[model samples]
Target: MRTNKNPSEPRFLFLITKPSLQSTLLLQALKKRFYNEVTLKHCDVIDSSTIEDGDLLLFDMMSLEEQTSRQWCQDLQNCQKKFKTLLFNIPPHYHHRDIVEWPMISGIFHTETGEENLIEGIRTVCRGEKFFPKSINDYLTQQLNLSHPQWNETVDLTHREKQILSKLRQGASNIEIAHLLFISENTVKTHIYNLFKKLSVKNRTQAVFWANKYLR
Candidate 1:
């Protein structure tokens, strides 16, 4: 994800909790292989001009140091207009919500992450996409295996919206959805827009993600 559409362009900022020569080495390792496509620097998130540009800010902060990180996120949220932040929080506490739950933070990684996870997370972050790893998902699934999940996605779903999304889940196109529901194609578009808005998703992929996650 450090690689941009233009190879010469860099799209990331590496924010370290405490700067050191060791971190300098890590920066060299990060950028050496990614081509001339990223700017890596050791910085304190508190007073970083590098972090203010709405670029991805990779923090190597810890959860025990929560207030500082929250202030850092609040600052980013206030100043940045358009960006996705990727946070790298170390072990013993992955619940660094102050930053990770910010709309700016599009992805998060644990200290124990592998190369594949890091790569995929960066890619997803660049696309403004959200990702929860299977290990995290598996851990959550075990704790929350209590009972049925109440599907409230359909609460705002109009009778027609539910029917429309059901058709969508069945892989129906606008023409097919129109025909199946006995509505015009134009009306179908209106309903589809409503579905997208009601579900708070801009595209079909997110709609499907929300549907499969909560509606199913």
Candidate 2:
């Protein structure tokens, strides 16, 4: 499918939003700041026909109701869209750590900010850089360390593998793990296989019993 391609000029961005006054304010500020420097579009979402390469998606994600936001984040992991998605808000309570927040926002410019800061965030994200609010930096660090144990400097298992095991230990099925991890069921099986091979286990039940053994 043909996207709004213009590689020679400024990058393109699309917003698939549920719509809110705060989102509207942010979009208006972005437009005013980078009128000629960027191309913008609005869609209901990056669906089967949506998303193109070199395009960054600015999701007014928090504008959605809580249950909707959770479901949307779930879909994003499984979505076939090729562009990178940056959610506007991180969950106030986080249970995962591998996800980075700084790459999503640069300098906590509010919808109240007029043109300058809004343009900065757009250009920053468009260039594949993220800016975060100064106020949230410490929180990011605290949350990162709380998710899973880090052995030496690296995770004992790759984050994906560890994530699946975590859910498995919690008694989730492969299908449930896949949905929670935003991976396909086949991929989940592959991860399970690799985990078995890596841990020298024969099956899921064994993996669960042995998962924490590698932590220390």
Candidate 3:
């Protein structure tokens, strides 16, 4: 499976219960779209020996049993290195907050998700950025606020702070944020520090978490 030895290349391993015409078509499309950049695989279980950092594990939720799907997600979490996981073909009526809240989940797609959106989501997740929909994010945020009432208090964020926070939520580095905003690295750091204080969070991850709950 490690036919490509280039460490810089991105690998995609699709874990489905079984193959179908839809899966075959989707794989073909991804191959054509990504060219030689992506390596595709289908397996019954994760083989740590072949896994690499930055590899994406796409779970076909529509094909797998509920308990099995959740277990596979947990198994990914226990892997030695960091890897991105995306749940696709999720049922509209499914409500598994535990899987949604898992740290390894980079995105989720429902059965109704369009092909274009799914392709874009795969690219986004592979780039180390999360790709959850607004509805899912809003639901998580609402649940967070319900659990922690202190965050319910109104906290006004400056226009600039909000912009910086949004970038942070996208997993942008300090340098990337500075470049995108056309601001100095020092200025970005200053804004980040100020926002951290305002959000009552110490670091970028916590600040992003706070924003996910408090901000839209």
Which one wins on TM-score? 3
lDDT tens string, model 2, 109-178?
3334445654566566666565656545565555433333431233358888878889767656566677
Give the per-residue Cα lDDT of candidate 2 at 80: 39
Over the stretch 15-121, how does candidate 1's per-residue lDDT look in tens digits?
45565675566566656644544554433436544443336666665522567766665455334234555666556445533333444446667778765676667
Worst 10 residues of 2 by lDDT: 96-105
Q: Alpha carbon lDDT of residue 177, candidate 2?
A: 77
Looking at model 3, residue 76 earns an lDDT score of: 53
Question: How much does candidate 3 score in TM-score?
Answer: 0.59
User: Which runs in model 3 stand beyond 4 Å of their true positions?
Assistant: 1-9, 13-17, 36-43, 46-49, 101-103, 145-147, 150-216
Clashing pairs in 1: none
Structural similarity to truth (TM-score) of each candidate: 0.51, 0.50, 0.59
- How accurate locally, in lDDT, is each candidate? 0.57, 0.53, 0.68
lDDT, candidate 3, residue 81? 50
Write candidate 3's Cα lDDT for 137-161 as tens digits.
Answer: 8866665443464443357888988
